[model samples]
Target: MTIRSRLLLTAAIGMAQPALAEVTLTRGSSPVPDGEALSTGDLTVQNEHLAFTIAVDSQAPWGVPRGAIVDLAPVTDGEIALDRIAFADFIPNNWSAWPNTGREVEIVTETPEKVVIRITRDFGEADIATTYTLEEGSDRIHLVTEMTNRGDVPLVDQMSGFTLWPDSGYILPVPGLAGVDSGSAEDALSDRVVAYDEDWFIALHAPYFDRVEYASKDLYATHTLAPGETRSFEGWLQVGPSGDLAPVVAAEIARGDIAAGSLAGQIASTSGPVEDSVLVVEKEGVPYIWTLTPDGSYEIDLPAGDYSVYATAAGYSDSAPQQVTVAADGSETLGFEDLKAPGLLDFAVTDSAGEPLDARITITEGQAPLVEFLGRQTFFTELDQVGGVQASIAPGDYVFTVGHGTGFLTEGEEVSVSVASDETQEVDVALELIARPYENDWYASDMHHHADQLEGTTPPEYVARSELAAGLDVIFLSDHDSTANHGALAEIAEMRGVPFIPSAEFSPSWGHFNAYPLSLGEPLEIDTSTATAAEVMAEARRLGADAIQVNHPFIPYGYLASLEAGTVPGGFAPDFDLLEMNGPDDDDAVFARAAQFWTQGQRIFLSAGSDAHDVWNDNTGSARAYVHVPGGVSADGFVANLKAGRAYVTRGPLIEPEIMFGTELRIAPDEERSLSFDLTAVNGLATASLIGPDGEISSQSFDKAPSTATAEFSITATPRTEGEDWVALRVEDTAGKTAYSDPIWINPLGEPDVLSQD
Candidate 1:
């Protein structure tokens, strides 16, 4: 069936019940006969005769291609195995849609978030699949597949599956998944199996996670499907021998994220009113025309033969799929089944000027059943050029609203429409001025990054330039005990018009929390070879800087130091800002611990940063801080916000918080008060709440569901009456984004002894 029918089915079923669509595929049936399929095919070593590669054998019936499982180049005396070939009795399903020739599995059953393919296996069919390996010659890369026929009569099974080896580097073409690669020398934690591109670069993302074990040198990653099932996928994977897959790949292949592939060979067609080239046809989906006021047609290609077509658009009733016959190399004329353009809902959004507002515009459906359309990308629709944009929607009535700044929309503006499929619905939009969404919102930031001074950029430049371009509101010039870029960036930020925080990544020769922000030239004065974290943080605070956090508290290197040890540190530098949440540096356990730290109130803020730096921008700026300044676009405002603790950091999401006792400035922690503020979001949905000064204190959750929401959170904080009063909120989104509000300055009912001042 075509994707049009599937989307329609989802929409209809969605209105009645909550459900998510899943894809399935049948057992492998041999399509092409296996030839000399050498048990030991080809083998070679490259990369200055360091890495190794060999043709994999077809053994277990799990789905993965027959190629060099390991580059074998990065390691000395590395080995490759060509184990058994056949069907994986263990796979037990048709997760491998095409059973034999080396298929690519972009989304697998393990991590069900992406476009997934699962196999509900039925043992009764004589289904077949294949699995292979080239591990340290371990059995993990081997395949054992078989076909069974249980019947009174003879049953012939023809199974087919494809396996394309991992490439050096690849550009994933999925809607949201981008540049990705795995397998590299820098993979210290060993969380990956089939590394995508090259090697030899220190790249890490989402580090603080659950598990940090080196994915066994002999790792198993495959996908399979069962009988009478179907699977679908888009994009491609580039398999090669030499490239960096060290730290970041746009998308994680995940535990079961088998592989990435191309949509190049899929069958599809496009049609609408007016043969306007403005709308270039993309991919294998049908376009259902609701109102074709002026019908137009386009061309499509199908492997020389009989074909079927389904057309659709929003708000229009789905039409019955049509079957058309075509001759080879032929062009056919197809028009909008119902020729008419949906009434145009066009608008010229502009700044205060009667002139058009030149901000990005997005039209999301506000009439219930909302879906996500934005992530990583800055605009709702592809920004083709400067000023103008046009979009096509189903003629059904819609409440269209547009947003430009990082704030809320001007309430959903309902627009009714009635136009022929061939007609254009023109409702020119005029965006008005509104408050900046992140204004006054607590923004979080991390002051470290390393852009090796080699690849046309340095660590400080990574902290300064690429980060700002990718929307990181704050960054510190923290290099590996190197002050080279801090001074350089301070001047460059001034010349290039960007913000730069002076800092340094001080390491004691031993690998530990190496990042600590400092004044531009601080690194030059410190003897990092002998300094302790306490001494570093002490100097940071002594420099009149605002805050300092213990970076990647869980990463183990020399001394086997843990976050717990760093926290007590002879009580030196005890009072501080945070313990790096280090989302990008975490393994599974690290991520869980980060969450636990927030819930338990570790006495320090939870922060995340991207420890990214590679020849390529792998997960570059994947994790960053979002400091909520006054949205006026000034350095002073940003600095004040940083000192105030109004910030959040993440690979995605935005937030804002405010606290008050009615109108009085005295919203003492000892007294309760009414609190309110706006929460603006993009890229991800999140949960937020108010927390007392104590980290372990129970807080309130957002309470309301936000769909482009401008919500009010009112909670009372009966703060400690004895101590200097302070109340704040902590938030984390479903996507792992974390933020901390700067403690609202509350008048302490009494003063506690500070040992020195008291």
Candidate 2:
């Protein structure tokens, strides 16, 4: 049957009465093979409306070892729509049985009408068996997990369930919430959670689950299990087309049999029937959300209980709660009175050039009538529309702050305004650019940034928006082990007139490396499963990477850590192009290590990045690389300059030395040269030091000097006893932010250096 027809049939089944359909289960190789990633004992299950593949043995990167739903798509499309869905860790016990564990799969039941496949894993003291079942005529896959304690100690406060990865740009629907992004719905209202994108949706109906938490790419639920006894938790997975979720909801309602009563209500405001409003019904402190029809009328099935009902809309006040009691199989009708009209706040933000500037807007005093989710407190201008935007907010006195990211001077840009009901207020904000590194042919880029990879909470569009707002000249996308957001970021970069570099953080068991300027449409060729650091770098180079970066080299899982301990597999390969100064905390350590390499006659340059994942909560470009792209900021130009070591790493301060770092100067012994430094900091400069292999050569204290400062130093070229001598600048601001410049190679003539040794 065609996928279109199957969708139609699924919709019919959802709307009509429940009927039985045949289900088939097959065990063998994966129907959709991903190389040699899956075990030979994979399972494929399908009904009239749904289909899925369970990886009995997963060997792919980041794959769950066994019993993970690796591939899920509509029976019609047959395309992979999900990454994977696997069991999460058991709480309190703090144990996860999947991913690097042994498991046994058994066919517990085989019948034409019903089929059940159970996967069992033993965790020494506890045994868990997760079963997948599909019955005739059912459009959902039912999953039940039973955990039993086998050891002498009793397991207490145990909770375990599955985690779902729906990729990026999926909306999550729960009781009391609609149109919430999957990452923003950390806490939902009901047991049924539906994540839908423009094409398809996957729903988790867990009537017995106690709570669920959502990250950017995945979400997991937990159910209470008792100790010393066997406990089973049940859930249903449903998939369908996007638009309507009726089919899944209907199946859940019918299976659970909890819809014993009905509540009908009408929501009306002073302006008449409220449109685009939400009806919230709370029973026993649990809130259920219902999307109202265009006429502001809603009818919902409920269990016998007393509920507090209210209504809320974007541009209106929430209706007063009305309490009503419902009997078994009974019906009740309730009406809501007036909902206050919202006031409008229109803002116009401009840059120093008097052009419309895309800025970040925040409400300091009063709250906006909009729903508050993760990172929703701040709004960006020109996100959906060009120029200024208007917001509907509650009528009150408010302090609205408008500004760009750190590079702009918006210190006193807060405006106070009183909003009246049904009134419009206008506010204007003008911001001045403070740090102008671009004018000096320097372009700033955050080397390590993520969007919707693993636990990342920011989407691609927001990633672009946030970085642009942070005044970054070049945008880089380096999601861990995935280039899924590369194309999207590239397109957005084109539209925003910014240079973009496509990169991915090759996450291996050993460490993580970022390979940049990767070609689009090319599959990631590097596999770190058993490859050494040197092999990974070779593969990255073979895959057409212009530069390979060692990320957070001094951290626990960093490559430098293993190299330092003399435990790096295949020993240390100094073939990497760049080494990261890594955010704020690792600057000193990384700098010290880089100095050692410099004194060893290695030319590995320095790079800085915030390693920002949740851009909404954290700032991107907090630590950035300033590269000298004198020609222009293009992907090729940036990479070329970075390869030549024409760059510096900074957290906030900007340093420009007269004799630019990365310049090779061949001088006679005892030749004197004068060097001048131009430094700028948003939060006043503290000190500037000229550093060499032996330590500080000369230093100047700024005493928290304002915005900009300068210093000059005269030094003589000294004979190198061993490796070539090099000098660099290190500056610290009063805010404790630091910047490190690439070394200025002081190659004294007739000295035994890297060249002579070679």
* lDDT by residue (tens digit), candidate 1, 1-758: 33234334755775676323211112232111221123443333222112223333322211222332222223223221221112111222212221222323221422211122222222233333322222221111222333333334433222222222221222222211112232222423222223322221111122111222222112222223344443222111122222322112312322223232211111122333332211112122321111111123333322233444443333232234455554433444443354223333344444344544334333344222111110111123222222344554444444554433322222223334443444565555545443334344433343446654211123444344344433344555555445556677677667655566665554442223433435556544444333454775555666545655556655542212323334222233454554454544453334344344433434344455565543133333455555655454345555444433445454444445444211113433444445554554443346656544344344434444343344344434354434443445555545455544434444433332111110
Clashes of each: 164, 4
- What's the distance in Å from true for residue 511, model 1? 7.0
RMSD of 2: 8.4
Q: After superposition, how far is residue 572 of candidate 1 from its true place, in Å?
A: 5.5
Per-residue CA lDDT of candidate 2, range 1-758, in tens?
42234445866876585544456777676554232225567777766656677766553343233555656554433343443232222221222212123678888888867788888876446777888887766657888877887677765544455555544334354664443333234355556765554345677776655444443222333433445778776777877743234455455556756545667778888878886565766755554434344568877666567878777766566777889897666778888866777888788887778777666677777744323321144666655553377877766677877766564233426878887889988878778767677788988888998887654558889888777767778889887667778888888888877889988887664467888888763566654544667887887777679899999887655787757655455777767888897746678888898898899988888988888876655677878899988767898899878867888988878887777677776666887777788888877888889999999999989864778888787777888788879999999888788899999888777443223211
TM-score of 2: 0.68
Which 10 residues in a row give candidate 1 its minimum summed lDDT?
369-378
